[model samples]
Target chain A: MAHTSNYILGVYDDEDVLLKAIKNVREGGVKIHEVYSPFPVHGIDDVLGYKRSRLTIVAFLFGLLGTSLALTMQFGMMTIDWPMIIGGKDYAPVPSFIPVTFELTVLLASFGMVGTFMIISNLKPWGKAKLFDKRITDDKHIMAIDLGNNQLEESAIDKLLKDSGASEVNKKTL
Target chain B: MIAESAIREPLVTGGKTVHDVTEDISGRVEQKPTKTWMLAMAVSLATLAVGGYAVMRLVWDGIGMWGLNKTVGWAWDITNFVWWVGIGHAGTLISAILLLFRQRWRMSINRAAEAMTIFAVICAAMFPVLHMGRPWLGFYWALPLPNTFGSLWVNFNSPLLWDVFAISTYFSVSLVFWYIGLIPDFATIRDRATNKISAAVYGALSFGWDGAAKTWSRYETVALILAGLATPLVLSVHTIVSFDFATSVIPGWHTTIFPPYFVAGAIFSGFAMVLTLLIITRRVYKLEDYITLQHIELMNIVIIITGSIVGIAYITEFFIAWYSGVEAEQYAFINRATGPYAWAYWSMMTCNVISPQLFWRKKIRTNIAATFVISIIVNIGMWFERFVIIVTSLHRDFLPSSWAMFYPKWADVGVYIFTFGLFFTLFFAFAKFFPVINMAEVKSIVKATGEKKQA
Candidate 1:
């Protein structure tokens, strides 16, 4: 059976209040969905209990791949493919390959990291996003709690939000 | 958050709130282009048209259309290439290096400077590709591709080939870094758009950014790593460019100090160009509070430091030449100072070396008019620096019989004008459409350091 998804949206005028409210609401045993703000709030992720990101690992791996690919391409071409005596240097010339290797490593690491980030975050040109509150992109901080995911009743969640200093509480169904 | 030293001045003045930042920055994008903007665009387009014709003629006829002497195989084209590439360095230095240092002032200017980096790189690429004479054929040939030509690959031992890889990688990575920063700002504009078309366009540009804490956390991490990657990448790019000259056996070009010297000179020139444009941009867009006099003074200090480094490098070159006891190297330095191109050499000394020394005086550093004039002079001096390095070194070799003075043709001047046209056209378009200042960043800083601190 098809069902509607319900969310209780708590709008706050300032980030500090929203941050403190998040901790308070969590301690009140209500499961939170997400918090949206106009700008990145310092310590919001840690307060929300988000794990540290591993995108840097992805970048490091991609950087290694770039280094290998560059070396293989250069070595394969210079030595194995068609060895020549230009500039009176050796066939492979590893020292000379440093510049291209460095460039390629940076190129792939950044590209791979960003590409992975976009995919994981669902950031695409055509991707649709749920706009919880329009002011989330302006000055307001929005904390959206999925009613279906929480054990508490809708009224209880709304009361918790308001008591925790929400400027206004609204319900949204999608 | 680290408590910023109370002694320091605020990065963002005017007691702005988060809403005020969005309104002020996005307001320009939402409004129709001002008369002044249209006037600037018209001038840029007209210059582009003239430059475009020159390009078409050069392509239609040949590289012969350029004022290049066979004797000076690399003249204005190479000089312009090095000059433009050097100018691209400051953007990365501000965005990447300054970020690593946690210099908060960079937030205000990095977006525009990074945009300048991309545009400058594009202009820089034009000289070499066009210099190839048949760029349509020679462009791809420069790469190390598996080709139809029997078993022939690009020489890995060659610095010119390193340049091909370095420039391409630098351009691509800088574009990525700049765009990643823009996405959040673009989403801010997307959400604020009153019209559907503008909303859809900015939405696509923003790549559907959700302001969730998790996404933002990841975004910050990505930005830091990219900044880390780009710092060394920017350094490597200029080092490789210097390698193109230093690896050569020529007298002036064979110095060991070329890499550091070239890098310092690049930052000197790049900051000058940044100051020149930003001085004009801040006034035109009325962003005085964001790009304050403190920012200008800070950049002037960078000019003083890098400009002095460049000055020392110049003095070192002379010392090395005399100490090396190589007759050709000595002749090269002496010729540069007292020969036919002595005017250019002295101009480089006066503008790149002596002029920035004036910034040591606080009075001169903070004066906007003086900063603007000296910025222009610094760029002119940098252009001469490259010209002197390239032409004087090549003009007189051991062969006195083949030595000839280079005279630039109309095409040489026109093509240079073409790049200026292209750079400004791209820059003006960026200014009009994209958020010139990073609104999200400014908002974050405003929260921390704005005159009205949040409770």
Candidate 2:
């Protein structure tokens, strides 16, 4: 069950060139591995054909849990456990519960969303990252293609990348 | 050929390229601290020292060192607490609410503003904790934990307890959001690091961001969801704060208008503080290209709207007091405007209401000097607004026998001074170490124009 990824890294000086190159390469029946840039290139996700994220759905569920927890905790503490009168109101004031309920809902939703994002992205505190190219974090735009996934010849792929205005193309194994 | 009717100006001025964006922002981080930064830091540190001394005296000598009598127990401490909290509102509003609205102009200013939110909240929290007279126990007692105090739990019904949760959650969430935004920029700095130590430091801060398309896609999703959560959260934080007063039965403090009024006032003062800081920051860092004149103009428009809302709220308070036929309420309002504390009341009226009207003039709104002066004026007015609400209401209550005048001792002024020092000290350090402008978001705006130029 051992496997390795073979990648062809194409460096572009401009984002538009990279966008166009992505279209042309994909149209030529090549499956792109991934693209990296110092910043997000708009519409690149659609061109790369990524599905819409469901993080919002996760946030909603977390919010529901927080709301229930707040309600139950407040109800138990006030009416059941240490019921005392402060403002001469009911032991369990439903109106007073709303503010804490709202705050906890937001608190849990935000924390859950961030945690879910990190888990899905495979981000671990101590884990090492797979760096495609050093310059990709700088001004350069890099498009990495998996050579193992493609049936095209090596020279043909090289020619395809060079023809699409890549400043440099190199092969790397991960 | 179709003729374009109007041309939209670029968000980023100076026609900066992607490389230039990286260099301009990251270079500031990489370079040594400038002389201006040093001077500001020195002043902030000195103020911090003075404030620290005052806090020490207060803690050693008890809350009596402050000017809190039995009737006016919550004077400058609560006023300062609420003032700092209100000031923290603008950062989240700009970063979260504006982001949801697709305001691209926020890209330049959101980072610094978010930092301000964190620091301001820190300053805000300091007051309630220290005002407890025993801060060490107050921290733990504030939490609803299972303790050995005869199975006693915190009063969930108390708005002060709610504030403990609200401010802490706000500070933590803002920190995470700000740090998440910084990761890519941190990675950029990591890649460009000339020395090993710098690379390792920034590399760790980045949390191994490789900028993969899939990762970028998730990052964007998380940011949007956080913004969605924060928008309501920011509103609730202030609403809960207003509840601390509104839930009470005090004549001036008890009103349904407190929530909306406080919220509007928070945004008004927050934006003013943002303008005050950003104006100086833009000039100091030579970042006019990023923090453009248009940004200032748009923020001024928000100020005018919120300021008007606050002004109307002030008028409504008086009308309601008179219309309600409650003698205590009427007397409280009259006392605020014409009593012993009339000077503070007029200052609030003039600064919060009349001063912002100047922004209605297009010439003044766009003028940098005018905006700068008005921003400072608005903040001073906001401080007075909190003072007027807390002191004026509490000073003259139902019983004439209990009526007492509250005046702040030196410690009250000293603690407030301390917060300014703490805020600027943290801000100056942030400016020196981190990327002031968000390079990644700014780059997105330029991509469209950059493509046209490349063609």
Best by DockQ: 1
lDDT of 2 by residue, A49-134 (tens): 89888888999999999899888888888888889997887998888888888888888888988989888887655545688888
Give the per-residue lDDT digits (tens) of candidate 1, residues A52-121: 8999999999999999999999989999988888878888788999988988999999999999999999
Kindly report which residue pairs in candidate 1 clash with one another.
Answer: none
Error of 2 at B341 (Å): 0.7
Q: What is the interface RMSD of candidate 2, in Å?
A: 3.2
Give DockQ per model, in order: 0.81, 0.57
Could you give candidate 2's per-residue lDDT for residues B24-72 as a string of tens digits? 9899999988888899999999999999999989888889999899899
For model 2 chain B, the run of ten residues with the poorest summed lDDT: B1-10
Scoring model 2 with DockQ, what do you get?
A: 0.57
Runs with alpha carbons beyond 4 Å of true place in candidate 1: A1-3, B453-455
DockQ of 1: 0.81
